[model samples]
Target: MNCYQKEDLIKMVEDAKQLTQKGKVADYIPALGEADPSTLAVAIYSGERECIYAGNIDEVFTLQSISKVLTLALALMDRGADYVFQRVGMEPTGDPFNSISKLESSVPSKPLNPMINAGALAVTDMLVGNTIEDKLERLLNFIRQLTGNDRITYNPVVAQSEFETADLNRSLCYFMRQHGIVESNVEQLINLYTKHCAIEMNCNDLAKLGFVIGNEGRDPNSDQNIIPLEIARIVKTFMVTCGMYNASGEFAIKVGIPAKSGVSGGILGSVPHGVGIGIYGPALDDKGNSIGGLRLLELIAKQSNLSIF
Candidate 1:
């Protein structure tokens, strides 16, 4: 079982919930903007049959950028490290997640990392499928197995909203295609990318997924290796260095755990060889992170000493 009590978790959520007033929901995607910014929740998964949560723990949100970590893992398993790294670099960039300046200047024009739009598109292109539908089904099935929730699926409304306003991502795709970093049709890739990003789940489900990664790819319930050990290490390492979208370094020093946050105000964190943390608070900071979620994580990590560093 987890170390913290239910009351302690609730208190931390209450403390962080106040920050919801100071931030805004992401309106760029209209569906995402509809979230109640005041919503806040936290869940901790500590091994088999043990989960604890506080606040609006049932609030479900889209995965957004958090899906990048999963795709990177699947891509590594499908294509292997050498082939995948050859298409994307390992370094972290200080620019925004959607910024394209680095792609233009970098040698060979590959994205600096898979966490960014350019690189994620490249990784999606390598997803080993006959068509977009085939690729998306594979991704959804993988996610369902990871969470042990067969009902997990993408939010069509959010997917449609993101696809309509994804011109910036479209541009990123075209640029990569010119450099041979991606070979799929631009629209198809965007459709698949948006759909995967729109996969929705509550913090509880997310925390379980995090547990698999931190537990060396083993399923806490079934004791099956869900992800390869080397691949899990690579994913968590990327989460530490690039998962927070250029705010990673600051988050590393403050929270010191591998985490990936979404504009929907969901943060997936895993303390290597320890517990998995999932938090959701739709009120976002200027950098698109969940402001209240970040605060709660800081408190939990400090109180529980969950940092890997």
Candidate 2:
């Protein structure tokens, strides 16, 4: 496939940014509620070359649900998939990220994999450490290593907002505890989970970090095995199956790439041997994915034949 010229890519991004007007920034978090509705950017990292972007590429944004995929990989690296799966199932729920219906049901509702809020919360609870500080240190280290950025930090405003409005997540944690799925204190787990969801990253860092997955858990630049190949495979599978909240299936059909989206208006996509792409446009669809980001990804993947299937 021919590589797209830098100018062409820029134009595509400009065209894609127009999508932001049709969607709304996530208002659940007052911090995210203030993002420039028209802000849009795209970054593609391949081997040693970086596209380093357009529009709002430099704007710092929280990881939101995208942090789930990273934490899930860390948990798998620490506990292996078998143990992790026991705590969370591997299926898509066709439901909102914060939905409480499944938790309230009598049916044995294991989390449908570690990409959704429930599963990610469960996975975050499993990160091995005696204290929340240690866990946060370790998680931050993992994220920093993947993104190749040592300065990354969590956004306090976003974390505080999520903590304040996280009733559904708290309920989910409580439900996990009742089901014996959560091994840690419910409140503590929610605290760690919210902080993780609040970790801040821009498009360049997000794309490079996601490139680790496309590179099969190995950091292309560092040549370090950040995660076992098996663990990476499981994470990618979950990304494809349930990464975009309830719209994962439709995204897979249209974009045909393994990706994860966060309520912070970011999408992280991986195409084997092609690219690791990141897009940011805080306006969200009902499922919480950035509508413009999703559209750009679909166009790029369709044109580039990047689908894993």
Candidate 3:
């Protein structure tokens, strides 16, 4: 019933694209810095296996922090909620995603939520693999299933860039290791974390991934569930509360969809049985979310009445 065409979304895309100038590309990660700040793209994947896209739809980008949500879902499936929640809290933090101030201040010393770097690292630590290569492959295979794309994999250049500049994340890992929230070699954990974050895909692939998440872990074309229903619910709940880094509260008020954003200017939105949206805009707000992508979602939510609230 919800078959959107490219013509239907072009206006919204163009309008949102103008905001690209208001934001800058994330430059701290050297490879991420190489992106063109003006590029903006989107794809909407419906339950019917239909897709509508606009802008630079072929551009491939790293998942960046967006991988956190997928990894969180995978972690929850591998380890039950009881086990996952014990390591990371459900509360959202007012601090930036990379900030470790809250970890030091909290009585029990755990990351506030899995959306943050510290918590993501802890969740990645829970992935069951005998070796680092196996762990990365497990995650990659899971992602390929989610997107229905057999060729999906990480960008080694981006992964290595992140690994080389992961001092802050390394520090967080060391601190968590001391607190027992993360029990593993810090170097190996960081390597795995970077690899997952560097997973690359275009807007179509991202939309497919989001569709699976929003569709309650069932693939659009499959009778079998890929992710458990309960696990999907928990992941969407976390997206609503903590997905947009420190800007989640404002984003929820405006868009009202469960969404997760990455520093690469990619946003994965699930409208809860409605549609899954993938957006890419290399220009990012101060909080590291895509400026054009956020505006585009706001427009789509308003026009389509897609808010869960």
lDDT per prediction? 0.92, 0.82, 0.92
lDDT, candidate 3, at 122: 97
- Candidate 1, 208-256: lDDT as tens digits: 9998999899987888998999999999999999999989999999999
RMSD of each: 1.0, 1.6, 1.0
Q: Across residues 123-218, which tens digit of lDDT does each residue of candidate 3 receive? A: 999998999999889999999998889999999999999999999999999999999999989999999999999999999999988988999999
Residue 302, model 3: lDDT of 92
Residue 151 of model 2, lDDT score: 95
Query: Counting only residues 3 or more apart in sequence or on different chains, how many pairs clash (N, Cα, C under 3 Å) in candidate 1?
Result: 0
Candidate closer to the true structure by TM-score (higher is better), 2 or 3: 3
lDDT of 2 by residue, 173-277 (tens): 888888888878877888888898899988999888778888888888779988788887877888889988899899888888889999889899877666788
- Per-candidate TM equals 0.98, 0.95, 0.98
> Which pairs of residues have clashing backbones in candidate 2?
none
Total clashing residue pairs per candidate? 0, 0, 0
Instruction: Give lDDT for model 2.
Output: 0.82
| Candidate 3 deviant stretches above 4 angstroms | 1-5
Off by over 4 Å in 2: 1-4
